[model samples]
Target: MSSRSMLLALAAVLLQTPALTQAFQDDLLQQCGTTTVFSNHRQGRLRQSGVSRVVGGIPSPEGSSPWMVSLQLLHPGMGYVGHICGGVLIHQSWVVTAAHCIKNEKYALPISHLWSVQFGPELKRFAIKEIVIHEMFAGYNHDIALVQLSNPAPYVPVCLPKSGQGFQGIRCVASGWSTTSAAPTTLTRRMGIPGPRAHVHLSVVSSSVCRNRYLSAYNITLNAGHLCAAGKGLLTSGTCLGDSGGPLQCNMADGRWYLAGITAFGSGCGRPGYPDVYTRLAYYLPWIKVQIKKHESAEKSGNYL
Candidate 1:
């Protein structure tokens, strides 16, 4: 069958299934928090070895981050607009990303269908059904958004935190497209391609430290909702400009990796003092459920259709 026809068939199967939050949480999802593809010899730890960081990011194997989804916007004339931001596959058809990726500075929401999901090795393109930004989002504070896929993605979903989970000071990892600044000033940049897609290890910083540091340097007062993490190792590089909306995953004693944060903003390409900011996933779990259920209800009643 034709590719378009097959995608339509897949979409048909998705529609027949309930997009209800409970069903999505309990039934649709599988054993999450485990990475069989980009896995480690030990059960609880993510693979932090092998790949080396030159400028900032380390090249994570393509399928290593199974839950990472690239959110792209499609244009009519230009077409094929690549990854604008990174996102995590939270539910079968729902993804979590930075709110600023969707909502404009003027608070305008973009047309949902123009955006698509590129997943797996083949970059299977899935259309977007809806875009939901946090109502309380203003400036960069609560920078989180939810996207409903037109069809279910046949990939593993990352686990969400039940509570705050006290992940502070814990080491976590984030994966996304690297920043051009993170690449060596070598032939790749000379050839116009720099900052390959990769991941970075970060030590989650305390909110007080983050607020104190940023408040002094940038005069930005961060609250509890925002998460802060800095690069590990002597080089001290981390999530850069283009890496926004990527998954900031933290592992717990349960031997499961949980979606900890959404890469929100940073001063530069892993600058020394300016640690990358992320929208704390644990802080917004309740709001995420509320938004998902509210919209899922609309979808079931054909209100969204």
Candidate 2:
């Protein structure tokens, strides 16, 4: 059998092995070459195919709102490489994304690699001032981190969900130029090549269901404090690359979108029978607040500070 098949089968077996939890984690790291990149050379073919649609309440703003930001990784030799992960425009200056997206050396994209934050849905860009990853976050903990923009973005801030807010049943929306399917289908099949593909999607999902069902496959650490959002339809709606570091907002009391989660992981791009996962923003508010304070303080101290 192929290595991918072996690992899947192993994962299936370990699902039943209580003693194997450590073993499973080790195997996942070893077999998958577990970096923040989360690549399985064999599984790359599984990511293609997700569908897209417009966000409901938020209409297009004239000349771009200050709210949205696209986090791009810039390598000195490579120029601007776009969207290593998704993030949200919480404050005019600070953006939030998964720590794993900006973590340690294993799959770490260098801090110097970050070039800019492009705002607006059409993706016009701007340079960033600094990236402050949380000091305590080990990245494996999959905590939150921030990217400070050089200038304030013009969009409005979305509502922040309370810390520890479970997305168990909430219907929420995620927006980004993430991944959307070019077409839709019912069957789950893996295709395409082994590198990254762009094109993004926005979708709604059920957190509770996704956490219970695909947690093992998707590298979910529920206690680590992330949220999950299942897709609304089969092969119809969800996130893709370039959609990283974006918002998962819920339709709230005032009919405005409340920031519920940040896009995280999923089995595939709106793959049939699966949900898109997001980082529970409610769980990370303190971290966001702290990071923003540091950035703000730095700005006050000196331009480089």
Q: Pick the candidate with the highest lDDT.
A: 1
Per-prediction CA RMSD (Å): 7.1, 17.2
C-alpha RMSD (angstroms) for model 1:
7.1
Clash tally, candidates in order:
1, 30
lDDT of 2 by residue, 237-301 (tens): 45432145566666545555567766666654455666656666777778777767766776678
Best by TM-score: 1
Clashing pairs in 1: 86-245
Summarize candidate 1's per-residue lDDT along 1-305 as a digit string, tens digits: 54356445545533454334554555537667767444332111112111111233555665566778777754455443345677899987799988887775533545786677767655456778888888888887888889998767666788898786657777777777554244356443222222445666777876786788789988887987888877653134364443667888887787777888888876555566667788888899999999889888987898865
Query: Each prediction's Cα lDDT score?
Result: 0.67, 0.50
Model 1 worst lDDT window (10 residues): 43-52
CA lDDT, candidate 1, residue 269? 53
- C-alpha TM-score for every candidate: 0.77, 0.61
Off by over 4 Å in 1: 1-28, 37-55, 76-79, 105-109, 179-197, 233-237
